[model samples]
Target: MTTMTTRTVEYPADGLTMVGHLAIPAGVGRRPAVLLGPEGPGLNDVQRRRADALAELGYVALAFDINGGRWFSDPEEMMAYIMPLLDDTERMRGIGYAALDVLRAEPRTDPDRIAAIGYGTGGAIALELGRDGVDLRAIGTINAVTTGRPGEAANIRCPVWAGVGSEDPIMPPAQREAFAAEMQAAGVDWRLVVYGGAEHAFHHPNVDHAVRPGVSHHPLHAERAWRDVVGLLAECLPVTE
Candidate 1:
């Protein structure tokens, strides 16, 4: 096993101070990197741990912030902030790009080989980055099957993978189909995995904050989704040991 180094980084985005967690592998030389986005609540310990895990796998990882280091414990408060941001495509893209720039600035990262993975609101940002035509090796989202403006998906130059829960009211069947349609229409390589009997935010365990009604954790499916995302990364951005 390789030792990993972690640190707190601060950057400006969306008119707020963004605090991100960066994890780097111990070995020398540039390595493929990943930009990690957290759920709507904000960047939490769970996401920081995920970044560390990615570093353990020999990839530089950065878990970017959404609320300037603040975590929203109230559902209504979270939505109050997230809903408007979601509606603003350019704002979301700005946040994602800011985080991407931070990751690329790390000396250990191979900027040319990078990927973006996010959950929920974070996932939407990741997709927006793809739609913005950022050069990414792969894009993976869990419980954030969203559609972008007409004809924008054509900008996505890499494969996209999305995971959703069958019982997720927030992202019901219709929404999934629409997302698939957009990807197909754009001729982009994309795939969607529906976790049977799961609900919104299925990959996230019970959080200290109050989540929406349909949001619940499915440990089994969560692990499976993690594996799927890892597989996507390994296939698209393999680490050269």
Candidate 2:
């Protein structure tokens, strides 16, 4: 069985208590930790499952919430709540940094070996954190919408691995290419993997809506992206033997 603890941490800015699941490997001492930023709206069971899986792999994982404790069963409602937060770039960056700090404060987590993994809106936040020079060991994103302002990629210091669906209309091929170019120009170590025929929100099997035109999930691609993320984490922030 995985050794994990669930708790709520208060974020003073919004006066909202964020739910988090901290999973630590059994018998491991001061292991590396991952601050997992959830998809745009909030922390869901999917993110929690990922955190649990990460903990089973011998790392302390903290899956945090940003959406003020509201779970939108309707896609429209989820977008309504998420869009506003995405528009506030500074707040998004703060959210990522705050979560990172929380993970670092944990006694079982190795502060120096900390990293981040974000999905969807959380992915953009992860990129923002890297751009702000967050001293992260590495960063990974899954189906992130790179809607932030131009030249923002120049701020990233840590290596980034971004996974996207080839058929994701929200982040089309042209946009992905431009984003990759910007990262290259910034001299940031980055890799972009496009899974053919997949769509946005591929990581979340529970997401049933087609937010983008002609886009849907691909289980095989999603699984591959998950493995790619795990491999990137291992390569960039290997656990000490």
**Of the candidates shown, which would achieve the greatest lDDT relative to the real structure?**
1
How much is the lDDT of residue 240 in candidate 1? 98
Candidate 2 wrong stretches, greater than 4 Å: 1-10, 13-15, 145-152, 209-215
Stretches off by above 4 angstroms in model 1 are 207-210
Candidate 2, residue 170: lDDT: 76
Q: Write model 2 residue lDDT over 117-174, tens digit each, in one string.
A: 9998888888888877788888898888474567666777789899998878778988
Backbone clashes, candidate 2: 1
For each candidate, the alpha-carbon lDDT, in order, equals: 0.94, 0.79
CA shift of 196, model 1, Å: 0.3
Query: Which pairs clash in model 2?
Result: 131-155
The candidate scoring highest on TM-score is 1
Model 2 gets an lDDT of 0.79
**TM-score result, candidate 1:** 0.97
Put down candidate 1 lDDT per residue, 1-241, tens digits, no spaces: 4589999999999999999999999898999999999999999999999999999988999999999999998889999999999999999999999999999999999999999999999999999999998999999999899999999999999999999999999999999999999999999999999999999888877832255678888899999999999999999999997
Per-model TM-score, in order, reads: 0.97, 0.91
